[model samples]
Target: MELIQVSHNEMAALFTRPSHIYNSVGFALLNAPKADSVEFLTFRDTRLRGGLILGMCGAMARSPFSAPFGGLLLTREQTAGAVEDMYLLAAQFAAGRGMALRVTLPPPFIGPGLYAKSVNVLQRLSGGCATVEINYHVDLRGVTDPVELYSRSAREKLRQARSHDCRFERLETTPEAIARVYDVIHRNRLHRGFPHNMALEQIVATSAVVPMDLFMLTVDGTPAAAAQVHRLNHEMAQVVYWGDLPEAQYARPMNLLPLEIYKYYLAHTPVRILDIGHSTDGGIINRGLCDYKESVGCRATPKPTFTVNLRREI
Candidate 1:
């Protein structure tokens, strides 16, 4: 096995089918503007097997908070030996550059067993000091019928929202539309006292590389709530950014928007999972946030972050 440094285009070409949006080269490109430096690393045997896209903050530290989730994107046929070799090479590279390696592995969207090899490799490398974040996702596979899948409370809220003559619109990905979506998201984050995850420029740039759809819920022809959804792959879709006016909460547009989004995908798309992302901040879980997601028929999954002290390992 050999580890090589490749361009972003090369990495994207090699890992043609990424399981999660966060693991894709497109996501790394979106984050590139904010990063001091970005590097795309590939691990190969006789052929390209796995790769990772990483960003750095100066020479001493790697930027961990840039991407929501990023680590190894590997094929199932790759052996455990290949996994170890890639990880060790990564560790050595980080050590040589005087940087600590930090990466978060997203939950497996393919099969439950797909992440087993990576988890084992991470555990050994991180000295069993992995931190787990609780993530929520709606399983859309068995949801042949929306009535049975959604909770009673959620269903009732959706009905109430519809009775108010709420309309859900799937907007085109135009610059004006993206700007409007970003405005709502920006205000929502400020209201909640949460830091902005990505700038509008970053979001716009990334959306161009990876196709995303913007959905909005309007009441009486007025925009109430919206979300930027990423079609991660054939099997999964994710709600990356969601926002609603404070006044819209009174009308229950939040509940209505996601329900409608799920319904549309359930009927029209082959996607099976709707990832709502983590309800945690800085390793602390928010019960109210988690409860709201549960009320809408979402369940928790474990997403773990792994860190290695390259200085010590070297």
Candidate 2:
């Protein structure tokens, strides 16, 4: 097996159709401003097997805090043996550069076996550590009625939102609209005592490379809640950022925004999963956040991160 570094466009072509939006080339590029540099690594045998987009500062580190997920992307046939080979090569590459290697794999929304293979390989590597966090996703496939997927309480909130004349609109991707969406997200994060992971400028850069849409829920012609969704592939899409005004809590536009977004995808697109993303800080699970997601018919899945000291002799 051989590991090679490729150009941005080459890496973009390989990862653009990934099962997770966070692993896509567009996401990596858009968020590149946060890293000192970004590298596209590919693993091969007799044929193309897997690839990953890595961000580096003093050394390459894969933190969900910086990027939602970053690890090996492999074909179905590439299992334990291939995973082992890839990591070994990755270690060698990192060692050559005198950098430690860390990677976090997204939840097993794509394939269970692949996730297991990756974990097993990481465990075998010297000084390896594996940690996990919970992520939630709403399954939208095979549901004839979108309302049927929500909990009783969520359904009632949707009804209440509609009663208040809450309307959902897909905002045009213009500079003005992007700025408006960013303001809502910024204020929401501040109110929640968290920082924005990607700045407004970074989000705009990402929009240039990825297919993203902004949706807003309005009441009396005023915006109450908004979200930005990124298309991962034919089967998956993710809500990268979502928030509501503090005053809009009474209107419950947050409930209506996702409900309408899910319905829109269900009726018009082939998207099977709507990723709500992980509701955790570091490795700790936030119970209240998880419960709210579950109430909206979202199920929990484990998203794991693995780190290894490449300096250790193996």
Candidate 3:
């Protein structure tokens, strides 16, 4: 029940914990923390109880990921009392420095029961939270036919691609594979007037810290669509980025791609939830994107950022 500034060695060890990629030391290394005071906590005994990453900005203590969702990370064995203790320690630390606390938790789907416990404890301490985004996932358990989850329009698109020479394969997660996938996604974003956030080097560096999977939907043995997936944990794999080549978009690579992505995770890995990622930008839901995800059999969950008033006389 003590709070201390984390060391580099401790940060690296914390990366191995069951947490979001953004909450890891690798991601923290990539982005320079802006808070004048940053709290990198490693709460442990003989066994690690949990970890918390918070950077303080004046009166507000926030997780490093202000835009992306990440924050308090706990182990599967972490009890409610343990979680509360971590928060209480963090709050005391922040209060001493005249600061508040903030954390952007991952969607409930990533860890349903775990998430519920976490939010409940955080709410008890942090007071409440503000919804930042709506995340989506494709549940792959107890499903014989993967295509059954797709919408009618999506099914029609798949039918349209039936005449094309299409094939889906899981590519090795190499530099070349990442570069190729990055190219398709970059172009896809630009063509659609959507903002592109990642660079090739960023993806390469991140893959070194976490498990990454590359998949492609090829037409006539040429890459037409691609998806770069990150294994969030034993139970989930998230598609961080995915897109089809503009020229091959006519072939409906997307329709074929989703089906392949769903099947590949269900068969090749222990992943039961394939996270399609968020369908919102800063809490503003994009209806078209939401529809597309739903059409592909994705379910939604609220991913919010919590705030705890540590300056109070607690």
lDDT of 1 by residue, 1-314 (tens): 77899988888878877776677776777667667788888887788877777777664334244756766777555677787788778877887788877777766654455467777887898798778888899998777765566778888887787778798888899888988888877877888788877778777887787678898888888888889988877778888889788877778888888878888887777877888999987669999889889888888888888777668656
Clashing residue pairs for model 3: none
Worst 10 residues of 2 by lDDT: 59-68
TM-score of each: 0.90, 0.90, 0.85
**Over 4 Å off, model 3:** 11-16, 30-38, 43-48, 55-60, 64-67, 95-99, 124-129, 220-222, 312-314
List, in order, the clash count of every candidate structure.
Answer: 0, 0, 0
lDDT digits (tens) for residues 21-126 of candidate 2: 6677767776787787887889987888888677776765553326667667654457688888888788767767777678787668766777788777887774
lDDT of each: 0.78, 0.78, 0.78
Tens-place lDDT per residue, model 3, 1-314, is 55666775676776575556767666665554545655578776567677777766777777754436665676655777777787777777777788777777777876666677768877777666565678898998998789999999999999988779998888898898889889888988999889878779878877887789998888988889989888877887788888888999889998889898888887777888888888888789899999988998999987776777767685
Q: List the candidate 2 regions with Cα displacement exceeding 4 Å.
A: 9-30, 63-66, 126-128
